[model samples]
Target: MEPGAHISARDNVVKHDRTDFEVPLMEKDFAELLPRGKMPLANRLPVLNLFNQAVSLGGLKAAGAKLRQDVIGCNETKIVVVDHGTGLPRSCIAF
Candidate 1:
């Protein structure tokens, strides 16, 4: 997608919903820099760590549910307690 395009989790794994940031280079700038060796310089733009929050939450919830189910299915009686105060919500941990 284009640099300023609106993106969502359903569109792809990368979430680009945020529009409050700026791109250091434009298409014209890139075209001009192609002749030089610095066209795709790594330092030209800031590094961003983007993730899909919805996909992450869904995976976590599924894992938690599977863990709870497996623990309950054990033949030996064991007390399984999950703490919900680390960072995730209580509902997520309770799954």
Candidate 2:
């Protein structure tokens, strides 16, 4: 893991069939991509800082399917998702 080394979702997910404007999923190349099949504007999720923090913590697969979407977005190259999570603890404020 060098400074400029590459970080990718390759180890976590696999490369499968998808279109130009899509990201590859897991296994089989491995996974699924729910309808509403558009990668949300990266800034839309609570994941702004620590996305992985909750994307799957609730087991909501589609909302958290970041790999494939990333594969395509990066042109199947680098898998970059700045998931640093805001160190401040957060919870369901109203719901």
Candidate 3:
């Protein structure tokens, strides 16, 4: 669910891009990322939840959504930006 992670659907086509997703449209984005035009609802719901949590957090959510560069824009969702100095584990977290 991160930008540039090389995700593949169970049917097996690779996603076309590696950018953060904008909400409302996020469902659509997830659909597009799938190989068979059939993304599992089970997987999608949690991602939306994550987006909702970010939105509840404030400005960081807005900035994260800004990465979309779309007029539809981001809502209350939070965006986290991190670098090499962040000190968190690289395996379990997203920057």
Candidate 4:
């Protein structure tokens, strides 16, 4: 998937804000995006497992867990979630 594509289980489509693009989320597309040999196997395995679990359980929950684990409230990038259809910000997280 392209950067900036919103993965939401609440919606049937993956939405991209910049170009107002919408596409169906399919297993093939996700499988093709998995990390390959260029990445270390040790690093890749956990990520692949997480990705598979996310696919099986649904995206939002898995993403939330990852965000909570990774976000440390440091002076770095900010992560936010917004209402995709309305373009309204819902929550902001800084790290």
Candidate 5:
């Protein structure tokens, strides 16, 4: 992750403005966003790596954890909301 973008995310959280995450929390900011210099071949939410999440964070509770505003707590986890549900094509990706 970029130092600037990463810290900017934390700063936004500190200020408690929680709605600007259209893509930063999902698509482009996770990668080199288009405006960062290179044009994207396609704009899409990056797929969730289930294997990675499984290894790193194991099972999630039946209910998702809350969306916390703690910038420091961000290092541990950032559960935005309970997931949409199972079997939907796009539901698996969280950011």
Candidate 6:
């Protein structure tokens, strides 16, 4: 990759408008989501399960999802909450 080289990416971009929202889940829906014996109980666990638990417990927004995307050669982690089909940033604590 050169600094001034011209490159084209047809459909290589994630076109997300402010109206993009993530799928929501609940705690009771966990069993249906995880495969039998597939749910890891090890360190850190899985973010998906934690997400479900949070919404069910009202710790996190019920219509939101966590996103960790790369931006400007850096990792931009944020919690995207659903705001009527729009993805809004609940909080973005960069380290």
Which portions of model 3 miss their true places by more than 4 Å? 1-5, 9-56, 70-95
Alpha carbon lDDT of each predicted model: 0.43, 0.39, 0.42, 0.50, 0.34, 0.37
Error of 3 at 11 (Å): 15
lDDT of 4 by residue, 39-73 (tens): 44652333324345423234555776667657533
Clashes of each: 0, 10, 7, 0, 0, 0
Residue runs of model 1 more than 4 Å from their true location after superposition: 1-55, 73-95
* Residue 32 accuracy (lDDT) in model 2: 39
Candidate 5: where are CA atoms >4 Å away? Answer: 1-36, 43-46, 53-95
Using alpha carbons, what is the TM-score of model 5?
A: 0.13
**lDDT of prediction 6:** 0.37
Candidate 4's error at 67, in angstroms?
Answer: 25
**Regarding TM-score, does 5 or 6 come out ahead?**
6
Best by lDDT: 4
- Which run of 10 residues does model 2 get worst, by summed lDDT? 86-95
lDDT of 2 by residue, 18-95 (tens): 353366664452123732756566546553224434443344555446645653344334444433232222222221
Ranking by TM-score: 2, 1, 4, 3, 6, 5
TM-score against native, each model: 0.20, 0.21, 0.17, 0.19, 0.13, 0.17
Model 6 residue 57 lDDT score: 26
Task: For candidate 6, report its TM-score.
Answer: 0.17
**Judged by TM-score relative to the true structure, which candidate is superior, 1 or 5?**
1
Which scores higher on lDDT, 2 or 6?
Answer: 2
Model 5 worst lDDT window (10 residues): 83-92
Report RMSD for candidate 2: 16.6
Question: Who wins the TM-score comparison?
Answer: 2
